[model samples]
Structure formats: C-alpha cells, structure tokens
Target: MKNFILALIVGLLVSACSIQRSAITGDKRAYGYSWEQEKQIGKEADEQIKQHFGVYDNVALQQYVNKIGQEMLAVSHMQREDTPATYKDTEFFFRLLDSPVVNAFALPGGYIYVTRGLLSHLDNEAQLAVVLGHEIGHVAARHASQRAFIQQMSQIALVGGAIAGQHFLGIPGGDLLGIGGMAAQVIFLSYSREDERESDRLGVEYASMQRYKSAEGAQFFVSLERMSAQSGQSIPNWQSTHPDPAERATSIPELAEEWRAIGYEQTIVNTDQYMGMLNNMIYGDNPREGFTRSGTYYHPEMKFQFSYPEGWHVINQRSLVAVVNNDQNAVSIMTLDNESAGAEASVNVFLNQDGITTTGKSGITNRGLQAFQAEATGQTQDGVALKFYLYSIEYDGMIYRFINYTTVDNYGTYGPRFKEITSGFRQLTDSGILNIQPVRLQAVKTTRSGTFRSFLPANLENLVINVTPEDIAIMNQVGLDERIESGTWIKIPR
Candidate 1:
C-alpha cells in the first residue's frame, strides 16, 4: 500500500512538469529532462567518454571533422532560419575518439563522437558529412530526450504494477525500483528504428544542401554490411535498433536523388583530399600499447612484460590491462599509478580507500624491483565480499599496481594464480619486441592495371592483424575481383 502510494505521487509530480518544444519539429512535448538539464548531462558524460576512449591524437583530423560538422549543422533544423531562438545558436562539439571500434554516436545535447576506426572505413568527405549530419539529426530532433521520456513513463507504469501486485496479490517486486535509475543512465546510448529512419532522412537532406554527394553515404553502409556478414552477427531489421545496413545502402541513394530532383545538385566528393588525410593512419590494434603473446603480455612503449595465467583471457586498454580466468569469477588487473611516487605509496592509497580493510601487509621484491604486497577485504556495491591481493612495484621512476580480486569463497582456489602473475612482472628488453610498430594504412598508386586482389602482396595478412585481401577490398569499397586502373589511388595496410 505504501509503495503504491509513493509511485502514484512520483508519477503525478512528473506529469505536472512543463513541456518543452522540440528543436526540430517545434512541437511541445513532455520530456524527462529540460533542455538545460540535457546540456548538463551531455557535458558530464562527455568528460567520462574522453577519459574512457582517450581522444585521437591528431589535431588536423579533429579540426577537419569539426569543420565538416559545422557545415552540416548550419543546414540542420537546429540552426535553420525558422528555428526557435533558444536553439538557433546552440553549440555543437564534435570529437574523434581513439578507439578501433567502427562507431559513431550523438549525445542528448550537441556532443558527437566518431572513432578513428569509422574514419578509416570512409571513402570521401561527402560520406563523412552525411554521417556527421546523421548524428546531428539525432541531437536536433531531441531523440534522446524523447527516449528518456518514454523510458520514464514505462518505468512509472512498471513501478505502479509492481506495487499493486505486492499490495493485492502478495507478489514480491525484486529490485524493480533500482532498475529505473540504472536504465536512465544508458538511455541515450540507443534509439528506436523510427528515430534512426528520421535521422537518415535528415542526414541526406543536410549533406545534400551542403552540395555534397550524399549518395556516397550508401557505400559506407555497404561496407558495414560486409563487416556484419564477416563477423557473423547479421540480424533482421526488426531485431535491430537501426535499419538493416543493406536497406540503408539502397535507400540512401534514393534519398539523395530526391534532393537532386528538387535542385540540390549534390555533387561534391573530395576523394583525393579524404584519401590524403588517411595516409599512414593507424589501421588496427596498436601493439605498442600492449599485446598478449603466448602466456605473456608485453608493453613495448612502457618497456614492461608480465606473464598471465595460461588460458586466461586478456584485455588491453589505454589505461589498464585485465586478465580474467576462464570461468569469469576472478580477475587480475594492472594499471600505472602515475600520481604515486613509490610502490608503498600506491599500496597505501589503495588501503586508505573507504570500506577497504587491510588484513596483511609486507615488503616484497620481484626481478630486483622494490615492491609492496598487501591483502585486503572489501565488499562490492552489491554487498558481495571480495578478497584482494594487491602488489605494487616501482621501476623506471614509475609505480605499477596489480590488483587481483575474487569472491571470498573462491580466494583459496585463485590466490596463488594471482600471486604468480603479479610476481612475473619484469623489464621488457628484447630488441625485436621493443621495436615492434603498429600497422598503418598506406595510400598506394597503382602502376599497372590489374584486379584488386592482384595488387595486394601475398603476405599482406601476415603484416596486419585480422586483415585479409577481402577486408582491404571492402575498405576501398571495391570487390576482390574488381579491376583497378593504372595511376588509381588505393589504401593498403602496411
């Protein structure tokens, strides 16, 4: 009875809030957050995203994307002559994230991001314009706000039903209240198919108005289709948040034709300039960051190596490296403590954290490096007890921290494995491993007419990670058997 009453009060309070006008449609609608609140949310989330993905370290590339984004934004509904005064001058921020995942997305406000992986797959500036415009459409249309509003309304009904069931039918509402709060945080990450279709139309419109070859966007979708098929994860349009890539590939050209018929005359595909920008761009995973070989993980740039347990899964990121046991119950993580002056200081910082109880502490030495070892007990946010084996080593004027943890019940089974992995850390000195460099995309001009496959070196796959002739063909938006003319520019991984 109390829960039901509380839910009713919450719903009524939400219903009483003022509605806002959409930036695109200019129609008053109920949104979960005001425009100002949406901006603040995006501002805060943008910081987290920068820290997580690390911005791509290319000022020229970033400025080029921003320049294109600004051009598209000018033609968008948010900046049109008839747009509301409140939205007319809204600032849009475009960022290039240093990730190898082919993805692009927009936040609730005007924050947009594209990965270098996506940039590498693009063929021309017009395609990039369409992509940025698509993300801009999402922001201009307030799709995130609409999705949040719908999510909140659904949560209200769910909460009301759960409370009613508990009060009348004596059914337990297992953590239903907590789910709403968690779901709200990630609501902007995805959108409905209708929202996607609307953005696609708006994308073509904006790019076409800019005199770009908006139909070029269709080739990018074709590459996406090939990628999906190669990854073996193709799904029906009904099960996807966005329309099928093949469908989009066919529709994008038609959308461009519609704009052309109405006097847009979209014809601006700067292929040479776009290809020049991609010259020597990082292609796939950078082994200089960290890479696993055999049972050891090596960091060529940091000049360190560590042995992980055999058969354990290893994940290397910019900030840390994680090794997980097969059953997924235990994990060992290594991170650089840039703020700490010494090994003991790093371990002390960990021990001083709230809710962390140090059970044991001792001095240790590994590979002639000064180190500190400690055992601690802590409870996760979910109240599950964990046993931690912490090790910190000072080497080359830097502190490297290894944090290994498992459930208290499973500590006995995994404690030795954790210790062995951490103890194996040592300076990386092999000349071959230290000199390894990341593969980069190289622009090559064909000297003789031949099929695309014949242009590639036989050992192309050996030089690049997870790359094949077909993959290179897809990157160039060509078929493997497609003929190439002499003096034509093509990208090859080198």
Candidate 2:
C-alpha cells in the first residue's frame, strides 16, 4: 500500500483552518498543496498509476513516442530545463498496452499512457500526433497541479464543516460524510466543462504547430462520437465527465476554423501505411487468456470460470461482469455482491427483502458449502419488469450474486443476453488459462533485418514481432526517426 500524502495533508490542513464558511461545501481552495508540497503529491500519483495498470513497458516504443512528443513540446511555451521555469527537466513517458479501449492520460510530472485500443483506431500518424499533443498540453498547462491545489481547497472546506458539524459542503457529491472523507474523490472528478474545452484547444494548436494537419486529428474524435452512438453508449472514465456530445462535437470544428483562419493547411501523412501497420494487431477482444469461446465466458483473474449457452454476447468491464443469455431470455450482472456487514448477514438480508415472494427455495453446495437458492420476481423502482432466481454463496468470506433472469425482456431479442450472462454464473478453478500472464509492451532495436522479438522476452512471445527493414526506413523519415541499428529498443504490448 502506497502512502497517500495528499490524503494525509488533507488530514493535517483541516486542523489549522477550521474557520467555518457561511454555508458548508467541499472545495479544495480552503486547504493548500503549495508548489513545495507538489513533490509529495506527485509521488503519491506515481504509486496510484503503477497500481492501476503497471507501467506500459516497451523501450523502443517509449523512445519513438518520446521523440514525437518532445517534437510537439519544442513549440510549446512550457519551460525547458535551461530557461529556469516550472516544467524544466520534465521527462515524458508512454505505456504500450493492448486494452482495445480508446484512452490516454498524463500524470503530474509528464507521465503519459496510451492504450493499444485507441492506437488501432487512429486513421493516420497526424491523428496519433494530435492525441499525444493534447495530452502533452495537459502536462505543460499544469492542469493536474491546479486540480491538486483545488483538493487542498476542498480539504479546508471539509475542516470548516467538521468544526461546525454540518452536512452538505456546497461542493459536488457533497453529502453527510462531512466533506473530509470524500473531498479528494470530488476534486479528482471535478472535471469542469472548462477543463475539457481547454484540452481541445490545446490539442488543435499543438497539432497545427507540429505541421500535422489539425483537421485529420479532429476527425478521429468525431469518429469516436459516431462509434458511441452506434453502440448506444459513451466511453467510461474517458467520457463520463467529458463535455456533453453536442458541446464536444462543436469544439473541434471551432479549433479547426481558428487554425484555418490563421492559414494552417490540412495534410494527410501516410494513412494507408498507418492502417497496414495494424493489419495483424490483435483485433476485437484478446482471446489468449480468458475470452468468450463460442458463447462461454472465462476469466483467469478470479481463478474461476464458467460458460454460457449459445449466441449470447458478453460485455466485460473493470468493475462489473455481465453476460446475456439468448435461449433463457435474460441478463446477469455479476458484482462483488458485498453487504454492509459480511457474507452470512448479506445472504440473510437479501432473503428478507420486502416483496421477495419466494416460490421454490433450496440449499446447494456447488463449490463448497453454505449456499442457498431462491426464486423471486418484483418490479424494480424504475417500473422495469424483474424476474429471476438468485443464488447466494459465500466464497472467501464474500457473498456472490448469481442471478438468472427469465421473466422480463426489456431489451427484446437483445435482452436475452441478460439471461445467457447470468446462466453462465459459476465458480472459477485453477486451469491452463490461470497459468498465463498478461503481456506488457516493450520497445526494442531492429537490425537491417531486425524483428520485434529481439526486444520481447520468451514469456511475451504471445505479443512479440519481427520488424521489417523497409518498414523501419519509412518510420525513420515520417514518424519516430528510424535510426537503423544492430540492436535498439522499441515498444510492443506484452
């Protein structure tokens, strides 16, 4: 467990500044994480990043990425090492991972990451440069630093509420937690409309300066919006707090117009070459470890896996595990299934819910012991028809919900996914899949005949490659300068 210095400081600052405000609210300005305190906060953020995704390691990829990124930075006003300014000595980094999700982010001291999912969708190098440029702007602008300072402000506000013992801190997500408890969370999520808009402007300006066509970059974001509409959902963390779709759609055109008015020309650099590079790049979902084999589901992380009936699709997220059933006409949502107290109490509490209306109940010991099943149906508060059989089991002192939906079909033919998903609910076991480790990105040097393998370890063969000489020559001139070498490092998803 890493020490959370900002959280600790939040604890300390509240003590000194207990002055109550006219009305309680959670705001970071009340407390302070001065420039002097930034180092500690950065340290904490580093630990958090490591815990979240493990540094995307690919040396060759990092070098190529850093070169392109620094090229963009050359035109940025952020301080360089010699000028004696705020961002001097800042080192930028990149993580290469095959996540299939379009996401990229920057940490306080120039740490940046781009998921392979987004990389695959990009139409060209200029688009890629724009994405990197926008993230670089975040680092240069010190927006995160500003947010951290806001956290301090929130802390002070929290303190005022504690002293007065009042509810509602007048801040976002303000509740009876006295603000002190949820202050950091609030600030982290306080992505005001202004922040996103600013990022868009910065991205466009940076791309324009790099001589990379800014409109091509804008087109990628537009594509993402189209994808979201086709899927009937927006991205998670990437979009949850982003400006509304209409607001977001308007931003890029405005930036493009600004660039055009200033005489910036549009350019497309090697769109086909870019697409060719992704020909064999693992498409859709990764199937090496746990994936939907036919219609079954498997996960190595939880150590237990199960299979569903035929034809049902699965949507796996970081937090929730869900599967839809076609034949049974239902969907199942798998969660931690945690209760306020503990596992045993949770089962009892669920069973005792009002209007449960149990039909046939029985006890079963599928994996081990202490498990029960009940059939019940009721209308959820949203007026959606609900029907299912819930099975509660205690595994590792945790209660798990294995629900089978057979009653309501809100999503219609597609709704069967819910039932197929819940039906596949079962315990995981130690199997061949559990033995495989996820691959990481590693950068390597390529010879005149250099291949991707020289950089990848034996264990990462599932993700290694052999680079071609012609490919190296092209990238050298157009993208990350391809200095031919007998041995060098490049990035690859592990």
Candidate 3:
C-alpha cells in the first residue's frame, strides 16, 4: 500500500507539471484538454464551420490571407524558442468566412476565421495583418484551453455533444436565435476581456515585427463605432466579444509608437497595393446568393422566389433564410429538409417530433407546386406556448420547408402573413433577375479634381445594393464632400 501511494503521488506531480503558465499572460493553468484533445476539438469544429459559414470561395483571396497569417504566426509565442515541442508542430489555419457579419474569432487549436464583412472595412493590408495576428495571439496564449479548464471546474458543459447532430440539437426547428445554426455559435463564444486585451497587445507586436504600420489597424475601430451608432446597438460588439473599440484605438496606437521607438522604423502602410487588391472584390452582400427586393426574396442559383410580410427584416444565412417581424414576436424560416421523401412525408416527420402537437390536416398549394401545410402547437425551451404554421413544398427534386411561429395569442394576427409567404413560393422565371450579378468594387481614377460625391453615379442606389454616397465615403476613409486630387484612384461598386 505504501509503494502504491508513492507511485500515485509521483504520477500526480508529473501531471501537474505538464500544465504550464501562459507565455503572454503569465497565468498558471491546468488546461482540461491535452494537446491532442485540443487539436481534435478544433478539427471537428472546423468541419462544422465549413458546412455552416462556408470558405469564401476565392482562391487568390484565401492565399492572400493565409500568407499574411503564416508570416505573423512565425513570430507569435506559438512559434517562440521557449514554446513546448508539443505546441510547436501544431499547424495553424486561417480561413475567410463567406459571412457578411463583421466578426472574427479563433477556435481552441489554432483555427482562425474572419468574415468578409470585417475584411471589406479594412483600408490596408496592415490592418488585416493585425487582425490575423490578434487571432494568432488567442492560440499562442491558449485562452480557449484556459476557458475550457474553468468550464470543467464549474461542471458546465463547454458545448453539449448532442449539438453535433441535425435538428439544431434541441432548438425549435425554425428560430434564428442562433444564426449560422447553433454549432457555429459554440465555436464563437466571446473571449474574456483580459484575453482580448492581451491579444491586442500581441497583435500590435506581431504587426510591428512585420514592418506594418500597426497604428493603421486602429482605424478599423472607427468604422466599428460608426456601424454601432448607425445600427442603434446599445453596446458595440467590440465591447462584448473584444476589447472596446475606443480603448483599442488608444492602446494600439500607443503600442505602435513604442515599437517605432524601439528602432523598427520601416512601418509600411501599402495603401495603394491593398486598394488594388480590393478592386473587383464583392463590396457588401453578394446578391447572387440571395437578396430581397420589394418584399420578395430571390435565390438566383436555386431559381426560386418567395415573399415575406411587408416591413419584416430578412436575414439570409448560408444554410437558411429568416424573415423576422418588427416586434420580434414572430419568425418564419425557410430551409432545406434533409429527408428525400415527398412533401407529405417530410411534414409528417416534422410534426412527429417530440413535444409538437399537430392541430390540422396537411393540405396542398393551389399554385401548382405539391405542398403540405399544417398547423401545430409547441412549447419553447422556456416553456412559452407557440403556434407553428409549417409548410413543406416539393421544388426541383428538393424538399423546402418553412417553419413559421408566434405566440399562441398573436398567432391570429400573424397566421395570414405566414400563409401568404408559404404559398408565395414559386419557380423564378425572370431572365433579367436571374442574371443579376453581385456588385463588384471597381477601381476608378478621377479625370478632374472634385468632391468625393461628385464622382458618384446619379443613380447610385440602383447601381449598388443598399449602399449610399455616405457609405462610399466612409469606405474610402474620407468625407462625402472631401475634395479628391486629380489622378487619385478610388473604389466604386459596379
């Protein structure tokens, strides 16, 4: 018994020693995940991420982001001389998400993602490097591992394993509470404030080492501030998932100055080069995928058309589309049903799910498509009573389903609108609409000096998708009336 106790004590000591302090934060942590476990989790989450948000689908752009990321990663603590051999061999992946949401995040084991929405706002390559470097810092400092350790201590599931399955793992089938579905949200949970700050400092450090003008990165925060104000958000996103934009604007410049004082004087802006790359890039939402015009939603590739209730907000995600009412009281989501069965069978499968009670028989659509419509009642996870209006339609060999819901009391007011939208589905046969290409940012040079607004097209609203002269001004980092020098290049969507 004495010998066995001695052996156990030695094993525990070895295990404890394996948990090392962070190189950047100096925080001692006994990470819940082994190096292999961390890699495995990230790999699994990465697969789901690709299915959810999709890869951006531009090879040159992908290569450009990876090139900058790998350069910064070489200088990060993950590749430092003192880094453990176990960590040194870990490969880092930098992916550009096709999403238009202005967001960036890192997964536990060296996977980083940035949305095109965030990329479009950046003025130069230096800013992009800083953003990539910040994500790299998260991996280098092992923030996710530390968070996982705390989650384990609290006995809270990091993310339930059941979330890996279909049917949104338990979320009501039609809600947009978790956009890009729930699995994407699991990998993108906000980082701690301290972790964000540490990553900020590391971002500045890595960008400076690369001879980039790190202060240029702070300008992106100005855009974020403008976006928050315009959207009427109570708190800016930076404050929630990242350090406050105002705070970062101050700190990043200060760090950049310090790096300059240390003799790294070749701070390159490379503005023109970056602007050249932005030429012909998709400026905002890619309307080719799906877009709403005059209360109608059109998917060019799918060649389908539908209409939602007037004045409702439309959220088009990679996997599904959601139409939400003004009062946040009702949501109607359209998504593809995985089952290959006919419309009636698909509706039967959905209604048969646990906790949902069907109240009516399925009916066919009068618009030529074979459709199944049913009314049902179900309770939310919070036990709130909800009235559901579901429709499954057969279109082009695929089963498309709409799950529309509202409170039991409000269903009468919302039901007709739901019925209108579900019945509105039809094959889109408009050639001009079908061939509508997404607006691409075209580089143009001024023939003569004038205010930035002078160069804008007369029918700017028609040319661009939901863009204004003011938006173009902000995108170019100038005032709308700011005078442009002759021969200077600027970007405009075409």
lDDT of each: 0.82, 0.53, 0.78
Per residue, candidate 3 scores C-alpha lDDT tens digits across 191-251 of 7999888889999999999899999888887777666666667232354656767788889
Query: How well does each candidate superpose onto the true structure, as a TM-score?
Result: 0.88, 0.51, 0.85
**Highest TM-score scorer:** 1
lDDT of 1: 0.82
lDDT of 2: 0.53
Better of 1 and 3 by lDDT: 1
Candidates 1 and 2 compared by TM-score, better number: 1
Cα lDDT, model 1, residue 456: 85
Best by lDDT: 1
Error of 2 at 299 (Å): 5.1
Measured with C-alpha atoms, the lDDT of residue 432 in candidate 3 is 84
Evaluated against the true structure, the overall lDDT of model 3 is 0.78
TM-score between candidate 2 and the true structure: 0.51
Single out the weakest 10-residue window by summed lDDT for candidate 3. 160-169
lDDT of 1 by residue, 1-494 (tens): 99999888777757744489887778898877777777877887677667656898889888989999999999899887889877786788999988777888887778999888888889889999999999999888888777767766666432222311231112122122212222226332358989999999999999999999999999999988888887687532212689989899999999999999999998799888888888888888888888888899999998999898888988677767878788777888788898987898899998999999999999988879999999999986678789889999999989999888888899999999999999999999999999998888888778999999888877875773678787888888899999999988898888
